[model samples]
Target chain A: MSPYDLLPRFKAQYDANNQEFSISGVVRPQAIDELGPSIALLRDAIGRVRGVLYVNVRRLTQMNNAAFHAFSRIIIDACRARPDLKFVVITSSVVGWTSRKFGRLSGIEPNITVEEYDSEFYPGQGFLEEGGFVPILRSQTKMTWRHERAILPRHGMRQGIVMADICCGIGDFAVLVQKEFQPSRIVALDHSISSLNYARQVMREFDIRGIEYTYGDASEMLLDEAQFDLVTCRHSLQIFNRPELILKELYRICKPGGRVYITNEKNSHCLGEPRAESIRWTYNEVAKLFGHFEMDVELGPKSRRYLMEAGFEDIRVETFMVTNLDGDPQDFADVIAAWADVYAGEMATRRGDGAEFVARFRQGFQDHIFAALHPKGYAGWPIWVASGRRPQ
Target chain B: MGPVQHDLAGEPTFEPMIQIDMEIKGFVSAWRHCDYVSTYMARMISQNRSDSVRHSNLFSSAFNELLEVAFRTRHADGELACRVSRHGATDRIELTFPCVPEERQFYEEAVSQVAGTEARERYLNSVSGDLAPSREIVLLELAVDYNATLRVEEADGDVIRLVVDLPLEGLQH
Candidate 1:
């Protein structure tokens, strides 16, 4: 029988391959003897491991003195017995206490170390988090809100529901949602510390309340299961190499019969009237460029398939086009210009693209902007909106 | 009989946010009361913070340790009252409960011990060296780790109050 059978309120897993032992959930046993099975499992796991043993408590939301004393004994005993074996305790900032609590172990043993598990969250999206990119994110959200404000209600968003916006970059969308839908409680979470800081600053400046901007990794969030009535992750899945992991988390957080709403773009579908060919070619290359980095920029149409595979029911999908005429043509042109600077200047150069290819790539975004600003011209970007209900 | 109020000169005063009073027997009847009270109170107080999830997590952890200590040390008779208040960035939690002379002495000594420079070292040793749970460990953790200012006061009758002033919002950094 698994050691977990004895501890109903918690889970303990030992991964032999990685020499990692993870304990998650509320561990508040009345006595240390109650943790016998889990302690034995840890001792056995430590006996078989060599070099380094990773203890991951990122998701351990609560642990009382009994459990803490028991775990401390195991760590101290293991250090004294195996002088060469290093112990690395992985903690999460989301838990708030794991880092400070486990950090003391390093001082007790020379071989023991504690590290917060947050690094390299979004691989090719680093440029999007630069200080300069904050304004662009705001502009992008403003442009999209024109379409999404109307589209949200159709996707099961309404007043008085508890909502969560995962991968909420800069939180402009959450602010707009709070003002419009008036969700009873809104938790806007993102992996970027800079983004969350900016979001908090914006909230403070605007005196906006009720939206909680939290810093967390999207794939393994600290949020409890079945907590949110509606969970929305916008334009985020396509940026991750493994969109399925994010989908699983979104699915996990949504209450039964609640909807998970997501929006993604098919970059190749970007169109403009006067400079249509150039815009199409550049955007298609944008798709290919993101593909080279393991991201799927063309995951828009495949949202239905992903949702179905993730075990969602009553799936709904729709597509909307944000055009230069949506509000201000200047805003659309500015977005394209920033995209050109990032895609051609930074992303293409980093990809080792030749001068000729970079020039051509730059030309396309410039032309798209040209069309957006032209009096008779029209520029449009298509986004696919999809929502599915978690099985009741 | 009533909630304890503290007003110090030149010190920032707190505005009362929530108060809960219950029989000490009902509270210490189950260990889960520590969890329930801490989690529920943390959620209710953290709703307006910049990061409610993070604030709630930290608040619950610190508050749970306090409640756990109270559970292990309280006298059997009389009432237990928990009051939470706020002033700017700081949060104040006042836990008033029935305590005999010995129980009050334990709290007084523990609060003084945690105020020493070696409080963190004592906390580390308390958790690592001893097999049995220590009542002073939670107080040390709050004083040293959470950077909370803890005070013990003797109230009317057989009741004693533990006041914890935590600048929780600043601790997020």
Candidate 2:
């Protein structure tokens, strides 16, 4: 069958001027035999065309192997029909389905070219729902303590040292850092005045003095340059529209011999059977919903490289797993549920399929609760804290 | 009923069809039902003998792989029509789903890319288990001999259908 017959199935469009074709939507199992005939009819149409023949799959939400192999055949056939054809498979990193790394059949006559590209149809709105999340985050100090143990600097908080924390939401980790390090001046900054006020309330409730709250852009802070003894940002850099700008600002503000610290959650792993694996699967899939963003939050080992690019010295990266081992599993459940509740509202406004997502998030959150119980221990979604000294 | 015909693998085959339209979970559920029913029917045909169990397992595995793909990439909109028929002793199952034009184009190309060589080895190793299963993967894992075909066809109402054909009789050695 002519490959063009499949055009309606893929919503593909061909532009004769550029000799380019682009397709979008979920690739089903039977894409080939369906489209092949229609495309075969195009051999004459393409054979007469000039320059490179570019086929773009970057818009696809996902593709299965059977479908991919099928599509590959149509391309090879077209190339054979038109030896001058230069087929380029444009790929995207938005979803896990499109592999940035693809394969080549060593001796294929017409070598098809593969190009990397990205088109973000929807940006993640989860960060805007921080209000529902921060309260739960505030109550999860046990997690903070666990992460701090692995990430905290070896030396205790030196006296008379000033520290700056960017995007310091509710100051959970900032308070812990100040308590342990006993830094003389703790400047906690966030874009949200409400979040800063909440952090202040936490400080007052604990009688933990030393942290000074500031409401402003964490990326473009008003703080003087090269002043603070230590500059820190945890779990929020990934949400920033431009992380490189903030990273540069973090480096710019730190005192030359001082250190800069940043941390993020890498991924989640399950130890139990089907239930654990199921939750992990659901969680990982949901995480992909947030992957269309320009910058990634889960830097993991890559954080060290980012730090190095920022011209930091003596970079050290440590991974801390927040298993919530010591905390009540209910705490994890409550947090995830609240997290979903918060996300549901904002996401509804951003996505056309927002309602479906809201339902999935709620269901996934509930499944996570069930999985959390009787857990022999879950690992991963590792929180990485990478630190580096600003070169003297 | 026509006279019984045996294939080289010594297993009988039949053709049947089914349809589906769902988001991820619903699709998965529908597929689970399909897997259970299809394998059960196969067992009845093969007569639950000692060797039949092995064939049943292979059937379920291949079917499960196809279901995984549908779960991952199949859109919630439109109906998915599945048909299973006999090719010699093999059951040639064909699944058709509504899709967009570009998607149809993409799959045609993907099929061509893995035409010859060690397609199964490269495919199985490259794909992360986290996503949908590939039909080819099911056959490869079972070490079975099968020929798979995927194509797009025009349906009524200007809708396009993606049709996948998998010929399965039983595991080879």
Candidate 3:
């Protein structure tokens, strides 16, 4: 018997009092055959609730289609019974919304509400649990950072210029543009099939027309160069092992006088130590790439420097300081863990204690680098944004 | 029996009950500015269930508090009224309100102002002094229905609250 069988207890408690209910249990995959039974039990549990059911589906990094189907059947059945039941579904990370089948599953039921909870939901670096923080952060960030910063500024009527969003994760920027700008055409490109599927689903739900979602490597995609009026590479630049090649592609695709906005997380180089050397190396490599192109550049103090070095002209850089100490200690710990995981490959071969060494060094980095550096007791990363125009 | 309190029980006189409920529901649904009102209401209604009459009174009071805090803050002339009546073992709360023609016109105008052009541009300029240079104004038009109801059914001591006729509309102004 799987832990999903325990859901009946939760259902009974919920029915008896209608109190806000929470179920915490571990799911072990016994075999390929056992997966179906486990999913059935979980679905049965979900069907018992009539009110708002917030399903936190975690440990889904290894979930396959059969597992997803099982989960979807349960959700579909629940929605069919009580259309008013609002289902809030959370996933670890969503790769593509426009191309993935599961991403489109939210559209299967009008009553089921699905949203991707990524870095925006966390206070600083914490994974948000139920009743922990506000659920609106994901929506707010999309409006502020993705919409206000990228989409709203560039949309217009009768403009021949089209937009190509490289690595359009979950179609946040793409959806905002399609809905707000009503652009002549938009090509949303992402590497993950799942993210593309979700993006497509959102577009369908919003009834947004004339947007195309493509699933392929943004760098290798056979797109016509100089066809786009604007090329946006939001938060996807650094992930490329060879960012220089990607920059070359961006330059080739952008029309003369067209603009490119690149945003990334700035590694802490303020520590003035071995960790600082690694940060400096990363920035230098990025700068060398931009030097090849004849464009003006602006360098932000944080992650915004890479755009300046990429030969972008009339560059603007903005620095955003975010702290991750708003919630419990465990939340901060989780953030540290995630940070370590993200940079583990790079941090492992370096010197001592891996990320912990870098983290500890960051604590005293300001004192060594800048006399004016304020030493506020907090744990968070600083993000930098840089935008530049290609010369005509 | 003395005054019959404006009795037109069967006259079918445009009982603003559905209209009022719909207006409140519309206001709540139109703007995705808050959480689900039914969920919040259910919690409040369940906690205040001391007796049938007291439960109704408390439900009415709590519902009004939610109305004032959530909907009244946005509109200047917003009105909310609630009446509790017992039908045998079950109790129903009916909310009513007088129609405000000016406010309705104001909303229609506001929607039109942001219709063709970027809606966010107009909204930002109206609300905040700073103008964002971006022309892309993604405006999700608030969905407002003129008739709706929130039914709370009690079966076997389990209270199931359902928000009916919740009109969902998407507008890009």
Candidate 4:
């Protein structure tokens, strides 16, 4: 048996067609001899590939000195041996160490280059994680929290349980959970550095303790299995192209018999008075707009099927509407205004929608905002809440 | 995020966080001990950081290097104590383990070399060199890559204490 088989925490794979060799997981072998199988695999990959050989370590969580030295030697030696071939080492910003460590190779050998793998995993991440969108996120959370604060208890949230808020955008929900539920421990993780930084700043300002705001890819988190008693991923599934992968990860981290909670929106269900037809037309377009980006904004009703397919048991699902009546009317209006800016302004423009289509799309959101702020009018945004237990 | 309130001495002081005391023999017996101890201590202390997971990963990697060095160099029969303390953005990891004369000299020289002007050059060479990985590579990493302050001194009798002050969270770009 190979040394890697003995220590299964590490995995190495090579795709010959792409000429890419990817390494993932923790690699902390005590001696360089133990890395023989991996090094051999890399050597073989190098011989077979031409042009550029991509060494991808976007998911490598840990690498000790012994492993680093061994890997560096192979790259440095290969660069000298194959002067015609270019080597690009792909690292992840989320992993924190791989970029700096592997980046040293680019300085040593001109043939070797280092590239931090950007957010190719989430197609819509850029539009959502921008600095201008942060306030909208906070307002959206504030609007949803009013309904969720009451609904969470029915879905297995309680004080003193260990919890994690995956894809915890700006961490407003985490702070609310910390204050309301008082989880003994809360690890709020997100892929956005600016969002995590903002979360940390808010924590320090409020002097709130116990929430660990961490940077990570929710699809493949480094957290140990079965560690959290309750794992909450709210209103984030619809943002990802492949949410089933995220649900699989949520299932992995959640403890057996523990619950994984999620909330998502079905944009077409959005309703408003005094311009109901325009609002409905625009929301249906909103769903299609998100679909153009490979996102499923209509994923709310599908949560139960996703949960069941992910092997979760005891699934419970509920729907709630965030209306202007829930809170200050202006807050709801602000959310609609921001959505108009993003969905119609940025997303629609990016999708190559013409001036006429953009005007109609923008009109729907404006009408929603108008309905929200009008003295006698009403606007409502529907959200689906679902939770499933990891089978014991 | 808040205004700086300096102490009368104008030097920031460390507040004790957490520590682990174990027998050197037991620690050195298994390689996994280094991984477990570093990961646990890192998780416990990184809760309040700007990015706890990133901090924990960085802290664990650096701390594990120290623990591995101690595991390789320590005397077989003595107490091994690992303590982590923090002051503002800086985290200090102090590792106390029993060592013989040669082991003590090895660490002292490594610490001195890390303090030299040519430390980064030496580190790059050591890590990239075709020879077997140098034992001092860990110290060089903590010094050059992490910009950590390294200090070593003789403790009780045969014990040597290695202190590494790492402002890891603050150093993130």
Best prediction by DockQ: 1
Model 4 per-residue lDDT tens digits across residues B79-171: 999988888889988899999989899889989888999888887787677555576778888887677989895577888999899999776
Docking class of 1: medium
> Considering DockQ, which of the candidate structures 1 and 2 is the better prediction for this target?
1
lDDT tens string, model 2, A1-392? 45533344345667788777766654444335655553554454456567776676655643444555555555566666667666666764322224332334212433577654533211333354355667687655656576575456642236578888887767777877776677787777765545666777777788877676754455444455798888888776666556677899899889999998887665433222335655665566444545544436455567888889889989878766555354776676666666566444454345444566567655655666665565554322356778889989
What lDDT score goes with residue A155 in model 4?
86
Model 3 lDDT tens row, A271-379: 2222345434433432333333321122234333455566767766665543333334234334334333322323322323356654543333332222122233344
Can you give the lDDT of residue A187 in candidate 3? 72
DockQ rank, highest first?
A: 1, 4, 3, 2
Question: What is candidate 4's lDDT per residue for A1-392, written digit by digit as tens?
Answer: 54634657888899988899998888888877878889999999988998999999987999998888888888888888889899999988787777878887888888989998755667878888874888888889998989899999998899999999999988999999999989999988888777888888898899889898887888888787899999999878998988998999999999998999999999999999979999999999999999999999999999999999999999999999999999899999988998888898889988999999999989999899889988999999999999999999
| Predicted candidate 1 versus true structure: per-residue lDDT over A1-392, tens digit per residue | 44533446788889999999999888877777778888988999999999999999987988876788789788888899899899999988677778888888888888999988866658756878763987888899999999899999998899999999999988999999999999998999998888889888888899998889987878888788899999999999999999999999999999999999999999999999897898899999999999988889899999999999999999999999999999889999989988988889778888999999998899999999999999999999999999999999
iRMSD computed for candidate 3: 24.3
Off by over 4 Å in 3: A1-161, A269-311, A322-337, A340-380, B1-173
DockQ of predictions, in order shown: 0.70, 0.01, 0.02, 0.56
lDDT of 3 at A115: 55
lDDT of 3 by residue, B21-78 (tens): 3344456443221122432343344332212112222233224322322342333333
True contacts kept of each: 0.69, 0.02, 0.00, 0.63
Model 1 scores what on Cα lDDT?
0.88
The interface RMSD values of the models, given in order, are 1.4, 20.9, 24.3, 1.7
Give stretches of model 2 more than 4 Å off. A1-131, A155-159, A268-274, A293-295, A354-361, A375-380, B1-173
RMSD of each: 3.0, 24.4, 23.0, 3.9
